[model samples]
Target: MHIPDGYLSPQTAGGLWALMVPVWYAAGYKVKKTLSARQAPLVAIAAAFSFVIMMFNLPLPGGTTGHAVGGTIIAIIIGPWAAVIAISVSLTIQALFFGDGGILALGANCFNIGFVLPVTGYYTYRLLSRGAAEDSPRRWFAAGIGAYVGLNLAALITAVEFGLQGDLFKAADGSALYSPYGLSTAIPAMMIPHMAVVGVIEAVMTSLIFVFLLRNNPSLLHSYDGIRAAATGRLQLKPLLIGMALLLVCVPLGLLATGSAWGEWGAEEIQADVGYVPQGMDRYLGRWSGILPDYAFPAAEEADTGEEPAGAVSLEGVKESVPGYMVSGVVGLALVGGLAWFSTRLLTRRSRKKEQLD
Candidate 1:
């Protein structure tokens, strides 16, 4: 779930950043030490997958929409450290470029999806898959179960973040200054769809992908140096590239999703739904104008014709939104994949230099 701006107090967001900075640093160090040339491309591909997978939003029964983070699958395929970096990069791009998540809330979003999801999912997978053969059905079951649990846990953490804003911050009139929903409202609103639907999707995706890799290119799967590697041989990129191409073709499905996330509504939308917008939210929300708000280009023709504002494009049933989303997906994948690949190349060079010195 992407918490938009004005959903969390500055204190909450800042605190999450303080917590995440060290985690990010540690993960980077670990990745530098463990990532090999053969594994680097896998990380880049996984990063691209993480970037693109979020484009396929699924409408929930309750009128809202959700999507799998792909964090657990990445963690199972690579390692948790690399998963953290990949997801953090993807979330940052979504926030800074696409306005999918709040810029101020980037830390919280990364913590939830990047850190919490992967670490929890990876550990759960290890625990359940232990003592089982690499290609055994038990390993697949473990991946599914781990993904289900990990996604739900991330949802729970997100609910707590929203709930805390209500509990800890309020206006002079007792109106919530940040997120209006308390624990009672936030927990159910976030948990239901994630646990019942989103988690299932995550589980199935993780298991299926893991199974495919095991059958076709098991060597590409990171074993955490035998701790988690499923199969061993040489790295393969064809399957991953093919999977990404298929996902890119399906990016437009996200536009078909019905409603926004529970806590991601803008101030005006919140007012329309609840009859009163939180004063703090109304004042602070729209702090940043992204290059592509909601992955749609500004309808310049509509603006020139006085049909709508320059940046206003209806999210519902718009034929033009498809091309815009497709472009966003492809561009995001390229940026993230290139960054990951470059970073790994640098790391590989440094490692080689160190070995020479030794």
Candidate 2:
């Protein structure tokens, strides 16, 4: 689901940024208004959960793989506005540090996963679970259904983003300049796996977590059903910490899945597979390099011999080693978790100061 650099034209990427800036601002304002000191830790933990969950990629029927974003779950647990901040933070770290996503396409990526998925999923869950109690089976079922539908919608939007590039940007010979595949190819290639396997994973994950939280620590679910657990001055952090630890343990499962995503291929791989790389992709995709490109560190031998490292794995047509993937996951978790925690703490302090003045 991480659209690497060069997949989108400058216009498309810029357009997405323009669309998202105001959305991000509004989310920040809304979150600031509603966020309490007690809920600060919840936002951070939810962000960490979103960060780690995206690491577990599920293999699809085709040679490609996708992961559950956990956006909707975060939205349901926290508010959609807060989910926006959490997911955007995670995606920003992945793009800037790990190179999991394109730098230029960060706006598009955040818009898809951070904005579209959470907002849509949150609303869907609310609509379906409206009359039901938070602990009701119907509410859980609604969460599952909402997650499934929300993830697919995000996938569909991503497909359209890719498809539009083909029509809007092309070479003199009518060849695509950025993403080569039109809607006919992009939609099916991206949506099938989500509609089948990935969606189910997201649905199950959301429902199970919702149930677990509801049973053990209903206070953590303050965002749902307008419940104010903080009124008691006791916040349950143990369950969330335990869940985060478990997710860390399961991070390796992402490596077990083989094949790259449908449209995230590198320039060399795209050219070899399609006989020619799209001009825009070839030009802009490799423009920026991250500390760990493809989550792989070049071997010391490569520095000495000036040759490609032997530790490279060709899973996504990139030389990403297993150790590199593990390191990237750990580092990403720390950075994202730290940022979320720090930001929420600051927001809480400011909110407190404002209340004192009031």
Candidate 3:
């Protein structure tokens, strides 16, 4: 759902950017008010986790893939505004380094996934979990459902933005055109499959994590419900560690299961159900460039080992090149995790020493 450059008209992109300015400011203000000294470390960890999670795209049915943005996780730990900042930074890094998303499309992506999902999810969870115990099954369930709702909502927002862009500049009808990418189309295209399965997976994962925190370090979660406060328990590190281990082990199995199904379905389902057939935008879209020379396929030097062109992107290439991806995944995870831990330790230790001296 990361809108690439040229998918949106200049006007649409500019409009979103304008809207984002106030939102970003609001998010910053909220962060200043909400984030405490103790919660700071967790906030950094949330950002790092989000960054790492998105690197692995889960296969969908249409050859296109989706990744966990972890907006809900961030919202759960911090407020939505902080989630926006974290996601924005993570997305910016992804855009800059890997060319996963276009820099020109940054505002739109931030608005849709970062702002829309986390803000809405946090509020919705707050509403549903009202009066529920923090560690209760109900609160966890609400979080899961809230996350699902948030993801679908973000998808809907993206679809509408795309549809509007498709119509505003692509169609002769100056008014909004009736297309498959409309709200109706977007709802089913993005909601149906995600709700059925992805929602459940997210719910289970979120619940497990929530429960782990509840049983272990209750102080880690500042805003737990009233009932949870009653259960004054000592922090148990072993359960949390074991739970995390289980999650790590299960991630691959979940990825394989969802990835295969989603990869097969995404192409046909989206092309058919959410097809935004912009009749006259190809010429315009093709001419646009981004931070990368060409968003779709930026030119790159040859591998120098008698390898294929670096810029070439093909479905067959992906299918035939599973091993390369596996290796990349291993290497990328190690690099990201090492960087996150090292940076966190260095920064925190420096800050702590400064505080002690003061």
lDDT of each: 0.82, 0.81, 0.56
lDDT of 1 by residue, 1-358 (tens): 8888888898999999899999999988888777655566778888889888888888887677899988887987778998998889888888888888888889999999999999999889889988987778888888889899999999999999999887799999888888888899999999998988999999999999888877876655555353224223456578789989999998887777756777888777788877788877776788885887788777732443335432344554456578778888888888889888776667667764654566
Candidate 3: list runs displaced more than 4 Å: 171-187, 225-358
- lDDT comparison, 1 vs 3, better candidate: 1
Instruction: Provide the clashing-pair count of each candidate structure.
Output: 2, 0, 11
Q: Model 2: how far is 241 from its true place, Å?
A: 1.0
Q: Looking at model 1, which ten-residue stretch has the lowest summed lDDT?
A: 224-233
lDDT of 3: 0.56
User: Taking the tens digit of each residue's C-alpha lDDT, what string does model 3 give over 1-358?
Assistant: 6665555666777788888999988876665555433344445556656665564455554444566666775687656776787777666655654454556677888898789888877777788888887667777777777777787788777777765543455355553322224455555655665666555555566666666666766555535631123223333335433543443433333223223222112233434544543433332332333333211123221222234442334444444344433433344334444443443344345444544666
Ranking 2 against 3 by lDDT, winner: 2
The worst-scoring run of ten residues by lDDT in candidate 2 lies at 300-309
Q: What are the models' TM-scores?
A: 0.91, 0.91, 0.68
Q: What C-alpha lDDT does candidate 2 achieve relative to the native structure?
A: 0.81
lDDT (tens digit, per residue) of candidate 2 on 1-358: 7888789999999999899999988997887777765577778888888888888877778677789988887988778898999999999988888677888899999999999999898889889988887678987788888889889998999999998999999999999999998899899988988898999999999999888877876665644543254633667778788878887876766776666777887787788777899888888887765787655565621433334333333453333355676777778888898898777767667766755676
Alpha-carbon RMSD to native, per candidate:
3.5, 3.6, 7.2
